[model samples]
Target: MQTKLRSRTITKPRSHHGKPAQSLVARRLPAKRPPTHPGEMLLEEFLKPLGISQSAFAVRLGISFPRLNEIIRGKRRVTPDTALRLAHVLGMSADFWLGLQQDWDLWHALRSKQAAAIARLEPLRHVS
Candidate 1:
């Protein structure tokens, strides 16, 4: 009678071809939201620290009181010219105002782009 040999069993298996495995890390992308204008933030900071009335600040800034109020209320936008005027009256740098305006502009631009892209997508329809 011939003796039969049994194959050896391996406890730990390496790579298919015995090569080292590479490591990879996956990261989640940031979520997007409706962009906001920064005029509100700048106006809030200007008003909050001094505890001054909006009307008074507007007068001092040479801007219409109603317009200033609108800007504060987020109904009106902060234009570069308006920001410069505000900065001059508030003893802030023009650069600071410009930065805020720039941020607001970029945000609105992105928001518009997003809206356009969404408009191009197919709308959901209900089935009868």
Candidate 2:
């Protein structure tokens, strides 16, 4: 008599971040989608809802009006220190601001001309 074996499939659980892991093919060439800047989120979700003016919010955060304006316009990237300050004033986590900045920066950078140029560079070979 011979024993028969049954095949089984195992499924991976979704990530804690709420997004499902990309399939192998999807990972190679991710779909191109524009990411919303953290500044936009701040303006629409926070400032507008709270009826806060840019100047007033800037003063509350202890940052210059111009600096806050630049951020609101998505001209400048948020530094870790600035993230902490925003988080403190908004009663949000520093990681929340930092993560938004990071995601915004990375998406923009990846979609830039520099990223295309970098992709054309030859890869280094492994040393023996």
Candidate 3:
């Protein structure tokens, strides 16, 4: 999914040092689309391009074919163990795979009902 992000300046409360705090936040307000699942990315970008079958890749990764298939279908999450295996087999960093999964999971969580309640929460101020 393509998302067009625009930057907005946010001013935060001054710290003990009395310096004006400002940050440029690139908010994705227009597009609420969830991030691409790592499994889908793996299937499209790596498996298909490299002409590797799911079963063969699973064997190489030392995982069950069904587990890999579930991941490809977006029914399973890519755990740290799986991420490390993928990194070792595909020559990509484990962080790359885990980052994708984290993004996907966070996007969904932020849209959940629990997130609505969390959004109404106010941060506690320190009296230092």
Whose lDDT is greatest here?
3
TM values, all candidates: 0.54, 0.69, 0.75
- Over 66-104, each residue of candidate 1 has an lDDT whose tens digit, in order, gives 988887777777777787887678677777666655655
How many residue pairs clash per model?
Answer: 0, 0, 0
Give the per-residue lDDT of model 2 (tens digit) for 42-120. Answer: 8999999999999999999999999988988999878888898999999989898877777677666656778646555
Per-residue lDDT tens digits for candidate 3, residues 16-74, read 34653222123332235878899999999999999999999999999999999999999
* Rank order (by TM-score, best first): 3, 2, 1
RMSD of each: 20.5, 10.8, 7.8
Worst 10 residues of 1 by lDDT: 21-30
Candidate 2 residue runs with Cα over 4 Å from true position: 1-30, 124-128
Candidate 1 lDDT score at position 64: 86
The residue pairs found clashing in candidate 2 are none
Off-target runs (Cα >4 Å) in candidate 3 are 1-30
